[model samples]
Target chain A: MTDRYKYMEDLLNRFFSGETSNEEERELYRFFAGEDIPAHLRRYKPVFSYFESGLEKELNLLTGEPAEAAEPFRRAMPKRRIRIAAGMAALALILSVAALLFLRKANAFDPYEGSYIVRSGVRITDTSLIRPEIEATIQKALQQEERANRLLLSLSASNPETRIEQIQRRINRQNEEIINRFPNEMKESIRRIIENK
Target chain B: MKTRHLIAAAILLITGSLSANLPAQETLKALVKKCESMDNVNTSVVRNRNKQTKKLEKEIISLNFSNNQALVNEFIAAFEKDKLMADKEIEGKNNGKKTLFYRFGDTSYSFSQLNEGSASVSVIQKDEYEYEE
Candidate 1:
């Protein structure tokens, strides 16, 4: 028994130094699995037991047995995939929002935003204060244009001839009324004189 | 996959920039901007709104310049190429005032030179107009 303990101690030292072979490591595991370990060396049993359980799980996975060997890998792969997907989604969302704001600002069409008024070497750009003056100026301009249009219509080629004819008819009608009001004998004389007969 | 996402983002940015880079034509609004920077000129603009909807329906721009025959002539020369609806060179009844009127699309422009060496230009823009014979 003392010889066995001495050998076990030597194997433990080699394992710590990473010089023990696989067979010797397996033997240490088997020794720790038994309850006959000396009290002084029993403190190292848990470490060998943990390594033995881990190796068994790895072997079970290699043999296609259902075990915890694939749990860490399964959990790790999805977490990485989710992180990548989330990053892309956030990037797309930021780009979309920025584009929307830029387009809206670029396309907002207000032609009169920079309208202003200059008077007597002074410039007035406040829309609210100058709006009434602007409206009045427009009204005056429209009125002036309307007057010009009316004048042009009156001066058109066909208007003066029609006006002359209407005026001639009215004058003849007035002369006839005046003759009828005069004495019957004098009416003929007056008509002859007016016609320059 | 990452390269594809980056390419799509680049395409979207390029499209947006291209749309923003479209050329703008010369309009009355552009003329108003020019007039704003000119010396000895008075410029005014009025936006007409619909009473019911409270939305902008039309715009009116007016410019007045005193003793600025050069500017008046410049405007006359520029507008002469456009379709003129009325051209009264000399109105003897109104002290020889010259008036020119032009209509294009839904906009109308009038340029007038008064006897006192004052020139006025008026622009009226509407959403639409009824067709006249």
Candidate 2:
């Protein structure tokens, strides 16, 4: 037990324990590659001496022969992680701003951005509901109106004499109402009609 | 490939969810055109039912809009003068509803100004008269 503890203690004292990084692990390899060991362990003399010759390798910290130099990935990884995190954060901020702008424009609060104001009390009609696409709606409404008028015309043609008499009576009543409704200057149209009749 | 398809489906779902609400929103040009085509009085239909009979009551209504400030003020002046004339003619006879003459396409429409910007006019005939029902 004492021998095991002593061996572990010496290994830890030279940074060959669990705490050894890539650099320190390689240092341990170099330190062990020797012929001369300590007096207590003279049977492993060649192993210790081989490591001592390579002690010059420990001094060459900048050169790359094996684990003599620092790891390239370890040196560069932190900066790359920081740069990627920064890019993600910037992207998130941009997306948030775009979302805010889209919400404001969508709510019809801005005139510069496309938005429609609705009539306050009017119940929305299906025909006039498509405010953004008014052309299509107007065309559809005009077609429907034309169809209704054509139906009316067909009905009038079917009962020509009675329909004409009824129309004449409605017109005469409307003319009387107009003549009673207006003043001298406003009644000129009715005067011309009466004279022509 | 399955993961890619799932991601694409999720994107489509999100966009479709956002776009579904588009129909409820209105545009600016439609508002301006409607404002332009407004009149001083328009008919509104009122439907009432008691037991087996459904009745329609036609009430004259006045129209006022923010854009027609000048016309509204003119109507107010005309209303005040008519009220003064009515007070002189009927001295003690006062009815809650009063009629003043309004013109529409060479026709006289009986109406009364409700306020500075609003007027009341007879709009629609009864859909079914109560006596007939």
Candidate 3:
């Protein structure tokens, strides 16, 4: 065999083994790109021909025709992927909003399904427990006012009705303050109690 | 002698009726005291005052009797009297167990009988009134 063919065989072995340097591969490509090959080396001609065609793509870029035609199809793939991604995001947002609205509507029917504070600052779902506590608050306020009334009667020689009216006003003020301190559910229950009375 | 016997019978009748109408407050307090003094009975009372409002906000008494069914039965019987006089006894569930609640005008008492002869009672008295110190 010729020394040129022996050199090509060494380069092909290096290339297959991934040990060929860029300069050595380029030397191989240049040697094979020239015509007049031996019959034994004909099988390797297609590989070097592929390299020659790749190098000739610079000429195609100078013409700027075929690359432009391939550009639209390459760009269309990314645009289609973007549209599909945007549609999935919008669907997820719609589903989240629908779930939130459904949960809010369900909670509105039983507003106290979760725990909330009563006037006594105790968190409980049962309003029956709160009713007795509210009554206790009012009764204690009345009892204190009654003690004050007794003192007022003994200490001051004022009219009983005037002192009683003042005590009643004080009690009313205290009761209003207490009811306002309660949470919404307890306030509703107290309002119902007052309306019934 | 016959007149004396009649007078004694009338006196006994009056006292019996009066005892029949005895207020539940006295009985409940007595039962709580008795249970608190027994062995293996844990009694605790928590008193809280609201600083801003200057009110005695809460007074809660809790009692736990462990392996003391006899004391629990006595206390239950005594509390049954109060339950009879309560305006309403609201049945409730706590931790998947039945709870009997007796609500007076201003105070509420809840009782639960647990497994293994353990029982608990809680007396909650909450009031919002600012008293002179």
Candidate 4:
């Protein structure tokens, strides 16, 4: 045992000087793991145990075992999920607001939204009260335009002789209709009277 | 292909500007807007609805002003200027009252002096005339 202690003291000096081999350092760790260490070596036992623990952690990493390095990443997973969920919720809110505005614009489009009327110097914009007047005004304007169209058509028609012939034909057709309304015996007499005229 | 696209775009822009600068319609609209603030004027705008679907269709603007020769002349001048751009024009006189009608594209305008102490100008859809027929 005195020889073993002397050898371990030599290895400790080599380790502190950074010149100890891997096998010598491992032997020193094994020696510190035994409870039979002498009272004189107790203070150095703690330093060897620390190195043993550090070597075990490196072996765990090489052997694909669970490691303390992954603990922080595992803890951050839930936070990432929460951030993504919050971003989606914000996007949904903005989309809904945009949709609402578009619907309002579509629903509010009206051609006659600002229609109004004036009566005796009073400007009235009440749609319900002026509805009839609006209709009447439109009707009057349409009628006036129709009259102008008819007058133009008449003035642009063929010569007076053609117009007179057309009028004569219309009168004859009217007479024929009137005669047809009479009885069969009186129809012939009515037609003959019309022909004589 | 890019030069062809550029030429097409230039043509489209020129035609768009030319159509937008139709002076007659612009002048009439400006006149109507100005008359809206006048005390002696009554204006009415009516949008026609489809008989079957109830969908809003064409619109008509009617303005009635107290008989003023100056206003009548202004409208006539606009009508005459529009006549140069119109597809059709008609002028008629009945019982000393003169009426003028002009059609541009799908829009028609009429200016009439009634027997009453009122003169009216109407901007209506051209289809309204066909509807009467």
Interface RMSD of each: 23.3, 24.4, 19.7, 18.3
In angstroms, the error of model 4 at B66 is: 1.6
Model 3's CAPRI class is incorrect
Error of 1 at B15 (Å): 25
Task: Give the docking tier of candidate 4.
Answer: incorrect
User: Per-residue alpha-carbon lDDT of model 4 for B1-133, expressed as tens digits?
Assistant: 4665565456445544544433445556677677767777777777766555556566777888876677777777777644545545688777987788876556778888875556888887644435221
Off by over 4 Å in 4: A1-114, A120-122, A152-197, B1-24, B51-54, B94-96, B115-117, B126-133
Candidate 1 lDDT, B43-128, residue by residue in tens: 77777666555567777778888887777666666555332212132133245676766554456677778646588888777777
Backbone clash count, each prediction separately: 0, 20, 0, 0
User: Which lDDT values do the candidates have, in the order given?
Assistant: 0.67, 0.40, 0.59, 0.70
Task: List where candidate 1 sits over 4 angstroms from the true fold.
Answer: A1-115, A120-123, A148-197, B1-33, B84-94
Better of 2 and 3 by lDDT: 3
- Candidate 3, residues B72-93: lDDT per residue as tens digits? 6676676664554453354545
Best by lDDT: 4
**Tens digits of per-residue lDDT for model 4 on A1-197?**
89988998898899999998999988888999999888988898888887888766778889988666677698889889999999999999999999999999877554454566765567777667787877787787678667766765676564233657656654543454454445788767555555653
Q: Is candidate 2 or candidate 4 better by DockQ?
A: 4
lDDT of 2 by residue, B105-133 (tens): 21112334444445433222234423200
Span of 10 residues, lowest total lDDT, candidate 4 chain B: B124-133
Which model is ahead, 1 or 3, in terms of lDDT? 1
